[model samples]
Target: MYNIHWEEKALHELEKLDSKVSSRIFKKVESLKEGLHLSDIKRLKNSDYFRLRVGDYRIIFSFEDNTITVWKVGHRNHIYDRI
Candidate 1:
């Protein structure tokens, strides 16, 4: 199984999201470490990375070595507002 790394950037993103959605997003991240690669992950570009849709929010992340690092989490309309 791969290791999941929650960078301060990602953790901060989680803090800004709704509780239920945040929980679900984390669950999915954990599952991915266990080898669940869905269409969403498969569709990622080499430089683009993976993204999961939680309502209108997007969980953006990437993998390095055996670690999955979540990069950002934000609504479809608000993602660009981050950073």
Candidate 2:
């Protein structure tokens, strides 16, 4: 199982979301600990990072060693813009 680590930016973004939405996103992220078997995961083009979809939100993260570091969290429409 990979350990999860949230960057300051990602945590801030998650906190700005609605409680229900944040909770759902958190659960989905936690599932990554079981490995990327979840169907929503996809690698970003030309980048080492991968994304996990949870409804309209997107989680931008990368895994190295035994850690999954979440770098950003935002709505699908805007997430890619900043990343």
Candidate 3:
């Protein structure tokens, strides 16, 4: 199982989202601990980060040494800009 760590910015972004959306994202992230691999994920160009798509939102994260570090969470149009 991999450990999941959320960055402050990502947590703040999640806080601003609708509860339903935030709940779904949180569920998905938690599922990663069970060895679930999201087929919808995409690796960012020239970076170690990968993005997981959850409806209209996107989760940007990187995995190393059994830990997944979430860097940002936002809508599809704006998520990439900040990363």
Candidate 4:
């Protein structure tokens, strides 16, 4: 299983979401500990980070040394803007 490390920005974004939505996202992210073979996960083009889609939100993260570091989290429309 991979360890999860949340970056400040990602955590902040997640905190801004509705409780139900945030919990749902958290569960999905936690599920990554099993593996990244889930259908919602995909590698970002021309980038080292991978993205996990959950509902209309997107999680930007990278995995290394058995750790998954979340860099950002936001709505699909704006998640890629600053990445």
Best by lDDT: 2
Please list the Cα RMSD from the true structure of every candidate, rounded to 1 decimal place.
2.4, 0.5, 0.9, 0.6
Cα lDDT of all candidates, in order?
0.76, 0.96, 0.90, 0.95
Candidate 2 deviant stretches above 4 angstroms: none
- Model 2: ten consecutive residues of lowest lDDT: 30-39
- Candidate 4 or 1, higher lDDT: 4
lDDT per residue, candidate 1, 7-70, as tens digits? 8988998988789988888887788887746755543555556776766777777787888888
lDDT of 3 by residue, 1-83 (tens): 99999999899999999999999999988888766367977899999999888999999999998999989999999888887
Q: List the residue pairs that clash in candidate 4.
A: none
| Backbone N/Cα/C clashes per model | 0, 0, 0, 0
> What TM-score fits each model?
0.78, 0.98, 0.94, 0.97
lDDT of 1: 0.76
Question: Which 10 consecutive residues of model 3 have the lowest summed lDDT?
Answer: 32-41
